[model samples]
Target: MRNKLILSVASLAAAVSLTACGASTTGSTSSAASSAASGEVAVVKVGANPVPHAKVLEYIDENLAKDAGIDLEITEFDDYQTPNIALSEGSIDANYYMHEPFFNDQVKTKGYKFEHGAGVHIEPYAAFSESYKTAEEIPEGATIAITNDPGNQPRALKMLETAGLLQNIEDDSAALTLTDEQNPKKLKFEENQPEILVQVAKDPKVDLAIINGNYILQAGMSTKDAVIVESTEDNPYANFLAWRTGEQTDATKKLDELLHSDEVKKFIEETWPNGDVIPAA
Candidate 1:
């Protein structure tokens, strides 16, 4: 009877030991699964103009970020100044708007540490009209409407100068104000807000207007009608992703990846066929 008791107690001890081992293995597995799930997700605030810039990010936020494990949210801005301000104040993670030249001006003047990443798209500054079929049809001494704002006025003048419609204009890194001293077309310049120039371009009275790429696309004008278009191959005004200077290492790298992704490139090609909007690859 004593020997039987001893064997029974031994079997019970072995069963308890097996149960404890099983519990430990499960606990370890559960811990590992939890650790794997703990990967961090950051909310990146971004700012962009409505048409292509904002529209493009909306695509990235929905598609690209899911794979990268990033949460990109955008705050749209109509004016150029506000987006940068939002970025500076930590309201947004990054901004995709102005070209390098304009971005540099904002950083230098505002004394911020903002920096730009990969060239996403180039909304080429182009001239368009509904009144006249083409530049050849527009008469000499025509009343031309141009954007009056400092940042855009220079761009408008540069496009006109590039077309050879206007002459002897020097491209300056400093402030550029168009003078009538060498006005070859005998063009009368009517200055208005950049947004209004689009309406003016379509007006019967307005002969020709230099419009931004966004506005040009918005107005339903074609590159065929674009007397001149900014070429992405050698274009100087390629738009890029902007962020605080120090943050360019990891977070910004993810954004660059998104910009250069096949999805983005494909989207631009299919969305703006006939090269209305060109990718800055």
Candidate 2:
């Protein structure tokens, strides 16, 4: 009888060990189910210029993304070329620095398989000066600085034309190039990258500098202080978000929606109240 009692006790201990293992397994499965039911947040990585593009994204990330069931990871890019390159290489899921013209040019020249959403905002191209307050104050044969990129050169030239600095421009297309005759003022054109145009503007020798609107904000320069500011009416240069073809997910669509929402428009208006950045219609 004692021997029988010993075997029964051993069997009871084995049953207890098995019961504990089963409970652990059941608890782990329950936890996994709970997680699956809650769903994971989608992450959308974006590359953008610092001033307004990233700033706008930052606003959306901080205020709107969580409710949309997604998260934004923004990578700031200072130059124009790298953002598109990063998008092409899958380093970033999307980019938001280029206007439609620039975006078209990139796809045409580099053959990037990219697609874009509607215009988000317009950073009006403006001309600035350290030596002169008005466009007319610029002297004849003045050395005016402009961007060297073909995509944006037309815009700078167009602004110059609006200032009556350039004339006889027959070809108004994106392929337009400034000729000696088009420059009626005999103004000398100094072509540089867009980012450095602000520094060129500060230079005493450079008579005028036509800078991008985003750069103006980045440099703490106000559009109200510009000698010439592009009109926002029917402007075609509104910047938008871009992504590789067929790579856009639901999260990216949600981001694009947030960018155009009324709340975003209010944020932009309040942030740059002087019209430095205008929400695209």
Candidate 1 lDDT over residue span 9-80, tens digit each: 224444234323321111222232243246544445566777788778888888887677556556565546
Highest TM-score model number = 2
Model 2 — which ten-residue stretch has the worst lDDT?
1-10
User: All candidates' TM-scores?
Assistant: 0.77, 0.83
Q: For candidate 2, lDDT tens digit of each residue in 1-281? A: 00011112224444344324421111122232243346656667777888899899999999998898766777776767767766776656688888887888889998999999999999999998888889888888898888877778787777778788787554242223456677767788788878889898988889999998888998999889999988889888999989889867777888899999999999999999989999999
Collision count for each candidate, in order: 1, 0
RMSD of model 2 against the true structure: 18.0
RMSD (CA, Å), candidate 1 to true, equals 20.0
lDDT of 2 at 29: 23
